[model samples]
Target: MSTVHKAATVSTGEDRKPDVILDYNKTKGGVDCLDQMVAAYTCKRKSNRWPMVVFSNMLDVSALNAFVLWSGINPAWNAGKTFRRRIFLEELGKALVSPLIQRRKSVPRGAASLRMLNQIRGQPSSESIPSTSTATPPTKRKRCHVCTSNRKKTSTVCPKCREYICKEHSVTITTCHKCM
Candidate 1:
């Protein structure tokens, strides 16, 4: 969540020469790209390391699904080691380059999700299951305002209000109870 942008010069493949780049170092974007590469590379690695696993996982024709379609022709083109390697390289190259070309096509995070996250961070309150007239107000659910995947696993507890927040989303400026 660091808004600090590092000005690192990287080469942009151009005919004239190299394009000097000065832009925000988006770690999230880089991580996503790396994930794709890892997935493709893992396929190749599996082929070389465990051919049987690669075959079984990829070539299960009975359950022909989206993963196989997205990943490309599964069975791994086991004509020969050289051919397989070449295909793997080619597939990897295609996988890496495709994202760059279709960069703008990525789905942007919505404002509602952000608002919900902010609400959670500011004041995390869940659905109020209605009760009888004599019943008391339901207890507020303590959960991450952002990725509401975790509830009591937060390390830093707010000093002022004692709100729990994950390390990733917790503000560095504010001192938690433990820090105090």
Candidate 2:
């Protein structure tokens, strides 16, 4: 039996490279453009916690991609490249925060509907709605742990130490006393 071997054909000059190389070059440019845009405003913070930093960087990249897509869709309203990333980021932050702030301000319709339904059923409402006041009075007023002043109204009780602390002595808006 005779063994036959097929020789590989080599392309000379212009045809030496594959057609996919051209497509790859074109696509690579787009990837480089997006990477450049993302790199322009990357979040770099020195912290012991890795999760927050990673999350923030992902958010930054997402924002950059959104901006690019928005600009592509609305050519007339497109901003110049010279536009500051800080301003864009600030606007993005405001856009995200505005809805939450509005949500907090407006009372949920479900609560009102539930109250009406309870009234129709002749059942007393479980909780009484308080009047809208700029200063929220404490549900259960107690003596301030820090100051030990019994006169001042304590708004929150510390969860950690289980001590009542007045608004003045509270470190954080949510957490009271030394637990903050």
Candidate 3:
């Protein structure tokens, strides 16, 4: 159905409502434009569940809004590409879940999926996994590596030094994402 209506403007010899509705109502016109843009490229599916429908709509709208913001912020990005927004959304989707996929511990059972996971892992063998196996000191007990021989027999081996260090000697070191 058309939004236009035959108004009394014909008697006044003017066109059917100038077509400048934004000049009258600003925000509602933006809402309509946004709705139209979201409909063009949406993740929405035919579902009876209202929540899923709402969620998909939210995703589509937010994605469009984010694309607009990103384009405005970085106009030089993909400067002359015809499908810049679509490409941006595709890359954004990949980036959103890439960390989760990269950190996946279990490899897929299927050959293709396993290969894909391996490619993401960038390592052929999991050989560097530190062996948590503790060696029983032959005598009675082994002393702690730190704390002046305090009786804390933490048998965790230091991965780097290959030494049986106690909790006191162990340090949990972390690095930033960019450095990694």
Candidate 4:
């Protein structure tokens, strides 16, 4: 991408080329032209001692570009009462705005494709999912021999102690948390 600004100097009767020319190599999926334009504006403003910042936020760059281009094609589009002269633009203006609007509206769909690819890997069957909703209540168990004083219900079977304990006391018999 390249930009050339030519000014006809009335004082010298000569055509003056731009003091700054920006040239960028074409890249795949890189920042768009509007971002570049914003950068250019920022760079130009920075050198002029313009105390105020030119552009700071990641604005709707494409909209700004379209607006600027529209204003260029017809000064009446400028921000002010002058715009009242014409509410809209001619065919030439539409031609210029269409591409910009399309570019702004366009979004990369490759991410969706990537997601689709990931989903294609595999999906588990319904049978793999245990049906806790209709699952039968767990059967009650006996108390742990180590803590014979407590008679509590649990899930684990402790062959070493030959006793069962509720989930809380199951640990005394060296049983699992599910047993306690």
Candidate 5:
């Protein structure tokens, strides 16, 4: 029982609403707007842990709120764009993870990962990613100097060996601070 209501009141008429409900309904507009944004796009993941769930929810709401504040301040920014929130969220996610991606020293194996890395960096998928940031990576794939098998093609050079090496022959090593 609510302190304000004192006791549950039986509705004599179908049109009657409780005083508590009326007070709650006053903020329904903002709640509905936030709900719509949350439903449309969210960072939520499937999990039973309450802390992760709460953090994900907070992230979703914060992103939407940030979008609102940004748009309100920059009147001309992304003008007349119908799906501006989606675009904003996408860019924000990329910007957040970009530094980490750039700092990664390991060259992940597999074509899919390479393609994803290239796409994230706004480069063509066919191009090679920097392995250790020693020298300017060659535009063309060179024959692996260390490859014993039928000469494997590679663009990455080994930082440890100081020689042209394919994914098969190279070990992941961290680069210097200046290189990073």
Candidate 6:
């Protein structure tokens, strides 16, 4: 059996409209080209809360706009799209939490400091550090080796040099001191 296909008619005259009318009107008040760009690259996941979805979408749009602006300002900064987006989001996240992390790191007077102090003492193993699960939390702040600031307690000890440091002095997310 053979199948037949109908050819589209070509309109040519003052009354004729382009076969594809490129409906910009429908898109005018809705999601624009930029929105499509952001949606294409956005990361999304299922969530129980509607607010979470809205927040995630907003974040994606912001990131997309940031990328576009940055690219416009710095032509030489071009990198692979996926890599650039990942890096941008990661850095943004770090920047947003840095202040809070610094605050928390400054007030470390609990099991965290104890762990650091134990590591600094050159103990061969965790067995050497006295485990005080039931002990009361320390009330005083410990000094940071990097800044030597007694204003804040030490958050973690540098694994490399075994020096106590506040969260601000920590190099990365792992909370290792800059000396490492």
Cα lDDT tens digits for candidate 4, 1-180: 233535522333255333332122224325665566455433233445344343433333544555567668877543576443133333445776899989965654332243444457564333233344654443666554345565555655543222344555545555544323
The lDDT values for all models are: 0.46, 0.63, 0.64, 0.45, 0.71, 0.62
After superposition, candidate 3 runs with Cα above 4 Å error:
1-26, 105-180
lDDT per residue (tens digit) for residues 1-180 in model 2: 112213333345576754455446557887788778777777767777989888877887799878767667766552665674567677878999999999875655443465566678888755423233433444777777677545576657554334567777776654454445
Models ranked on lDDT? 5, 3, 2, 6, 1, 4
**Best candidate according to TM-score:** 5
* lDDT (tens digit, per residue) of candidate 3 on 1-180: 224534423222344444344334544778898989888889999999999999999899899989999999999999989999899999999999998888775543533345456667886523433233653333434554445646676545444324445655566532112112
Residues forming the 10-long window of minimal summed lDDT in candidate 3: 171-180
TM-score each candidate: 0.19, 0.42, 0.47, 0.16, 0.49, 0.42
Q: Once superposed on the true structure, which residue ranges of model 6 sit more than 4 Å away at CA? A: 1-36, 40-43, 79-82, 98-102, 111-180
**Model 2, residue pairs in steric clash:** none
Model 2 residue 62 CA deviation (Å) reads 0.7
Candidate 1: where are CA atoms >4 Å away? Answer: 1-52, 55-88, 95-105, 110-142, 146-180
Cα shift from native, residue 169, model 6 (Å): 39
Candidate 1 lDDT at 20 equals: 31
lDDT of 4 at 41: 33
Off by over 4 Å in 2: 1-32, 78-81, 84-87, 103-144, 147-180
- On the 0 to 100 scale, the lDDT of residue 42 in model 6 is 77
Model 1 sits at a Cα RMSD from the real structure of 23.3
Q: Candidate 5 on 75-131: residue-level lDDT in tens? A: 788888889989899999999999898877574654446656677989975455434
Greater lDDT among 1 and 5 belongs to 5
- Which residue pairs show collisions in model 4? 143-164, 144-164, 156-179, 166-180, 167-180, 168-180
